[model samples]
Target: MCTLTLAWQVFEDAPVAVAANRDEALDRPAGPPDVYRASPLVIAPHDVEAGGTWIGVNEHGVFAGITNRWTERDLAGERSRGLLVADVLETTSAADAAAHVERTTSEHEYEGFNLVVADAEDAIHLGWDGSLSRTAFDPGVHVVVNVGFDETFALPAERRDLGERQAESARAVREALEPRDDERVEGWLERAGTVLGDHEYGVCIHGDGYGTRSSSLLAVGERTRYEFADGPPCRTAYEPVGIEGQF
Candidate 1:
């Protein structure tokens, strides 16, 4: 059981928003976000592997999201999950941070995984299968799943329609927030909820066997905000929260 779903790193006039849903769940682990938490700003319901994290944010406005790098099992490393989270938050730049993670990962053994790291200036995607590494992300919105393919891959006809729908939803979200009122944060949240309404990205739910254990909505930028709630409905009624301590 694991969480699988799409995440949006939204930048509004007020604050950046990280909104996501937990697709599935296995055994709930004991952690800071009990729901989801890692060292410092790293926050996710659980690790991608037994010891790896899937999504995390640092107090420094550094954020990362990891997905299984689907590939032949031949490539992997021995890096601990905790180390991965720690390395990114402590590093100053995405390139330096990626290098630190890649170097350490090469020495250790682990499963295939893709990590998305972002700071105020840049966002990077790192694909690793233990033996080889590739970086494939720039700025702007990108979608990731449990599959391996660059952004250039042509979408199937059916998927193209789905993509259009998601894009439209995303656009609507952007348009609705054009005014960016402080009180409208709630409206923005509602719009986000509406955009994701009834859309199940399968990966997150994973065949009912694994229901999302937790879900998170995060916003970064000048003032970072993180909101967490249980999965399925993916609510945000709780207080608008911030990561405690420094990265």
Candidate 2:
């Protein structure tokens, strides 16, 4: 499970902004953001183990991300959910991506997950547990955790505390961005970095076996930008990644 927040058409100058903190076992092997050699040309981090990705943006100006759903099940050798975001990036618009998630009958082979696909004008959240649910995001701020949007999905009692923390973090982020003076992407990135590192909860979660690995901030406007932090936001700075080359 991870933490992700989205601001859709929240700013006049910048139509879309997303902030995410990816939590996983520190031992998982992955690479930083790079141009994904696919039909639509995506920029995302490479999940070496699964040969997929967690977050990415395509040349069509569509940005996508996936988060694991908290459920009691073991799909040990099943298909990787990390690739879902990249798969959605293959489409040209958020509507097409949502359609892919809605009609894809093959998703049952994978574990529970939430996939968010967004373009300049549209944003969609597709949730798949045993069944599927879709939410067309309105022009406002939205937060999603592993339990699904607004914590509508079931979560074990032991993990409920962490889930609450995630919800609070989302509210904190929204408050921080709602009435800001600066409109530049750089300013948003800097503010996002601070909020992503909030230690009250797992926004920058730390534990014996699992913790935050990296943080990503994507801004879509006149020109799209993706900034990645190689390590935890508490100790790392975000760097702008180039999506032109394979590296």
Candidate 3:
């Protein structure tokens, strides 16, 4: 995943809402959403090469997703970061998932990554780049990209700003998350797609063989509803995915 925006306990009724754009080379092999009856009972899309996932939700109501962190060093022979998302999905709580990532960073040499793990009650943001740190989400919206969490919205320091492209993308997503009176989850999902399709900020990045491959929208409350678009949101419509057996 590249650009991720999460709304946590920000809406009156919905406790969690997530919009993510997975940016990668167009040739990478991946599948749409499905139920995996593995140890943690996952519901996620699959990455064929690494046998892992970019985003997923487990039976325990734990939602896990990962964003690559920009770095020049390549730690060869390390585990795939996609596998980290899969492993964290097996945990019961957001805290446990964060801890699971912390443990892995301590024992292995992997590339940089920013992970977001959440449940109905809380969300945990973990960043690993030779070191690991955990941050709990406040009752509001937050955005994370390859540079880590964007603190410019919460803090006034210029140093907290994200990269130019990422900052622009975050602004677009934030505008899309403005309050809407409609109570239907579908409305929010549609707005999420709009944010993903916004090209002004590169939310739907594409050029020179790399681009946004898939988009996902998730709403978790009394029930979890997920919508997935197989291709870029600019050209694809999100289809309702059955997540009954997943949780």
Q: Which 10-residue window in model 1 sums to the lowest lDDT?
A: 1-10
In model 3, the runs with Cα more than 4 Å from the true position are 72-74, 152-162, 181-184
Candidate 1 vs. true structure, TM-score: 0.66
Cα lDDT tens digits for candidate 3, 39-137: 767889999877889998877778888888754455552889988898888889888888888888888877778889987688889877667778898
RMSD of 3: 3.5
For each candidate, the alpha-carbon lDDT, in order, equals: 0.50, 0.76, 0.78
Model 2: CA > 4 A from native: 72-77, 105-107, 150-154, 179-182, 244-247
Candidate 1 lDDT over residue span 80-146, tens digit each: 5445755676666566677777787667776666566666666666666656555545433454443
Residue runs of model 1 more than 4 Å from their true location after superposition: 1-17, 23-25, 30-52, 75-77, 80-82, 149-190, 193-197, 200-208, 234-239, 242-247
Q: Pairs clashing in candidate 2?
A: none
lDDT comparing candidate 3 with the true structure? 0.78
